[model samples]
Target: MIKIVVDLLGADKPQTELVLGAIRAISENKDLYVYLMGRKAELEDFLANVTYDESQLEIVDCTQEITNYDDPVDAYHDKTDSSLIKGLKMCRMNEDIGGFVTCGATGVVLISSILILGKLNATRPALSVVLNGRNDKPFCIVDCGANIDCKADRFVDFARLGVAYMKTLGIENPTVATLSNGIEAGKGSDVIKEAHELLEKCGFNFTGNIEGKEVLDGNADVVVCDGFAGNVLLKSIEGTAKVVFDDIRRAAAGASDTQKAQLEAFIGRLEPKFDYNNEGGAILLGVKKPVVKGHGAATDKTVYNTVKIAYGLAKNNLVEKISEEFEKK
Candidate 1:
């Protein structure tokens, strides 16, 4: 059985959506077990309205709540019994528990995971996010928003982690690239220049530096960069998607009925490609166990997908593989 701890008390939406989504997921996968942690009253109240097999769901009472406005570090420290903390603690105690999923503050989740669960080996946990691409394969971006300033060695480790992830997902010999303003080896900053040489020396398939524009073109299987650069790239993609979608919506308004229908269909096809919620958030790679950090404003679907991603990580023994790779370096 795959045990998953879910922090139901987090997120902006009513807790009912999370409960309902969990119910849907559990019903679909009998091998899965969920430990829902949240306020006793709030959780019970929500459960009272839903119909589910009691044997499959376990509720742990957590009176304290972590709000969006609270400082992430302070929230984790002050609210020891917060749903997020409880869920992480449960995962830590139970070896059988595959992973911990939370829509809580990203900072809190990342820090708590590192503090309680610890890192996989010597690697600083990176926020590895899946980037939507034209091909069936999903591109993995490391340090999406985790380590703002990272050393050249860290970037090399990120490359290894990214390759392991892609391999687990069935992509063999994944091409790794560093994000840069130009494709030339000498184009980026001193850090990138050093990272380029180090990655080239590494045994893995390095594709040299990849320009920002070519990222969406599916030029590389794994993209490596410091958190600051990775976060900027991620936000740029999001912002561009939003702008294009808004323009499409406005254009649809002026089209004929048939034309509008076609436009909507096209938008529908493109929407999922850029929807971060659909892909869940990013994985905190290099941890001893799989830890997924969902968006603070994550919905039921996003939470569900996060659970699935965790399950995949555990089943594939991703952490173990990463450990072996790190040991060799």
Candidate 2:
């Protein structure tokens, strides 16, 4: 059985959203076990009689909740008993536990994961995110809001991090590209240009420079960028997806029934393809343990998917594979 710790107190919605989602995940996989971390009183009072296998579920008692406004560092010390911190400790202390999944403030989770689990020893931990790709598989972007300002060598480290991630998804020798203003080698800042040069020599099917427009269309298996650029790119993708989904829904609503049926079928397939929920959330790579962050507005479906992704990461032992790649003495 795979063990994953979930921060039930972290959802932007009622904590019930996260609680029920964890229950749904447990039902989906018999081998999966979750330690739901939150204040026990509210959870039990809300879901005391909910039917579930006793063996698969466990409620870890926690008192505090970390909010988006909390100064992550201060909260790290002051709110030591918060669900986010407690969940990280659960991941670190339990060898049976593989990783943690949280719908909390990303910054707080990032801070606590490092403080609790520590770094992977070779590389500074990075946030690796999976965005919509042209195919069934998603291309991963490393440093998606972790290190805003990064060095050229860190870009190289991000490349290795992205590579390990793609392999776990079963993409053998995933092609990589450095995000740049222009496809020409010299178009970006010195950092990107140098990173490009390094990527070429670092092995792993490194393609040349890739423009932002080409990234989601499957131009590369892994697009490496500093967190500053990656964060902007992630939101832009999210916004565009929202706009497109809205437009498509409006169009389908007015169409004739036959046409609407066809449109609905197309959208049903396309929605999951581009949906962040199905992708779960961005991964915190380069750390000793797996950490996944979902959008704060996550629903029960999104929460369920996040746990599933974490389960895949833990079962595959993704962190250890990453350890072998960069933890060179």
Q: TM-score for every candidate vs. truth?
A: 0.95, 0.93
Measured over all alpha carbons after superposition, the RMSD of each candidate to the real structure, in angstroms, is 1.7, 1.9
Q: Best candidate, lDDT-wise? A: 2
What is candidate 2's local distance difference test score? 0.84
Model 2, span 1-329: residue lDDT tens: 99999887767787776788888889989999999898888887877678778799888899898999999899889987888998898788888898899989988988888988988856888888887677655799887789998989898888888888888888878898999999998889989988988888876588889998998888998899999999888778777887898898896787899998888787777776565655588899977788988888888777788898899888887987787667542
Over 200-304, each residue of candidate 1 has an lDDT whose tens digit, in order, gives 999878999998888888899899999999999988888888889988889678789999888888787787667676677789898767888777777788778
Look at candidate 2 and give me any clashing residue pairs. none
Task: Report lDDT (CA) for all predictions.
Answer: 0.83, 0.84
Give residue 207's error in model 1 in angstroms: 1.2
Question: What local lDDT score does residue 139 receive in model 2, on the 0 to 100 scale?
Answer: 91
Cα deviation of 83, candidate 1, in Å: 0.8
